[model samples]
Target: MVSKPSSAASARTVSVLALVAAVLVGAFLAPVVYDAAAPTPDRVAVISVDGTITSYTADQLEEDLHEARENESIKAVVLQVDSPGGSAAASEQMYLAVNRTAQEMPVVSSVEGTGASGAYYTMLPSESIYVTPSSVIGSVGVRGSAPIGGSSNEIRTGPDKASMTLDHREAQIETLKHAFVGSVMEHRGDELSLSREEVAYAKVYTGARATQNGYADDIGTLQTAIDRAASEAGLENYEVVEKEPSTRSGIILLSSQNGNSTVVVEESPIGYDGVRAPQFLMVYGQVQYEDEVIGNVSA
Candidate 1:
């Protein structure tokens, strides 16, 4: 027996066949499409540090460290440090953050070019420090600026303000310097036997010298540092999470005009010269000038 199909039925059959063909094609190309489109997960949060270590740098490190701690997938943190030095306060802040993060997760410091003074100080809190063979490290000291008196005549202040004399101020500055040196000694005494005098001197040293002096741990590249951190964190395959500056919680007010200014003026006396001609005749002359003129000229 032979059967003839209706036009509408034949059209429906063709549509079904086309749909099946499309489904097969999609299945065959699905892996290739996903492989090309999907982004590879990063395994480490790498922070690069260069130049002077400031509060901004410290804040950045702290933010990244906190992010790594919160992210379960983020295994380790690799701090790539290459800085000479900066403010002691800034370095201390960074050191505290790194230390706290190390307690929770593995944090490694890698010296790429140089890490001296404040730079080295920031690295001290890490679990283990890695430095390139040629990298410089280990100044490990503190420095600050003190207000030195210029001259008694030049120094002026409000009536209620206490005056600072040169000798007394110098003695106070010296005392502060001694106190700072003592603090450095306390922090680094166990790691390296550095006397207060040595720390106060603020000396620089090479990577090899740093390791020998117990300043740095190992001499290796940044990659080695990352690997070590990962190994210490016990993470074979993990994802890296970078915390952007904008995503930070606190508010940063960066405005130049936040205060007011006022000006004050004062008047003082001046000396005049008298000329005597021969023994019989004497001549004296006085010049009149406004206080504002004198103040403006002096200022």
Candidate 2:
């Protein structure tokens, strides 16, 4: 019409219309109209192992582990530990419970302040262990008052019946150490980089040194431990739930199905003076000498 627009101009006009059409079509069908799918969240159960590991502490741990086991939401467990060790039997019970939990799902032992001796022993059952740089570890040994000599006032039936002789006591301790060492070796297996003698000496290793010596898998933070647990459990988005003891009752009360019940009360800051018999305790601390008076003032 104005010389009927040139063929080149006509082609350009059609190209512009086609471009606009494509843009308009794309806008109508854009994915931005829909929100992204929500990620499935998993649950991680954290149980504390603070202070000394007593029989009561072991009971709580068992209950916590059992609860976690029963909960379908819990994908893994993290033992947040800070203990200088405690009763050997209690530690063993906790270890057995942890081992059972591991068989079901991933379990991680994360050390905070100090996870030594019996506390460290409890770690053997975990799939992996993590500790902060300054955390204490090891002291793979036991210490308790060895019934020094038989009572002169008390009459006994046999030579060893009155009390465990010094020799037998020493031998018993060695037996206990052997068993402890065996458990450590069995659990750590080829991952153990330290020599048998090093382990036998019951030396504590720092986090970095522990990893180097294979006493620990890595030096990491609590979050790192949780993340490791999550990875082991194959979880992306996850929830962390801490299971604090529901009751602070310092009493052990039990009742049978037939209604026979019993309750044992304890003194706060409980004394470990062998009230439950001389304990084969896997504890670490300055040992009290016979000559020194306990709970003495510095002044």
Index of the highest-lDDT prediction:
2
User: Candidate 2, which segments miss by more than 4 Å at Cα?
Assistant: 1-41, 151-153, 157-160, 245-276, 287-299
lDDT (CA) per prediction: 0.60, 0.77
Writing each residue's lDDT as its tens digit, candidate 1 over 1-299 gives 88899999999999999999999999999999999997665467777665555456677777777777786566678888877755445666777887787677777889978887666766666777888777777654433223334455553477546455545545654664454455445555676655666766666667877676666777888888888888887778765544443322222111111121111212212232222111100001111122223212432
Q: How close is candidate 1 to the true structure, as a TM-score?
A: 0.59
lDDT per residue, candidate 2, 198-261, as tens digits?
A: 7989888787778878888988877888888899999998999998754454332211122211
Per-residue lDDT for 143 in model 2? 65
Give the distance in Å from residue 270's predicted Cα in candidate 1 to where it truly belongs. Answer: 41
List RMSD in Å for every model shown.
16.7, 12.8
TM-scores for candidates 1 onward, in order: 0.59, 0.72
- How many clashing residue pairs are found in candidate 1? 1
> In candidate 2, what residue range of length 10 has the lowest lDDT sum?
253-262
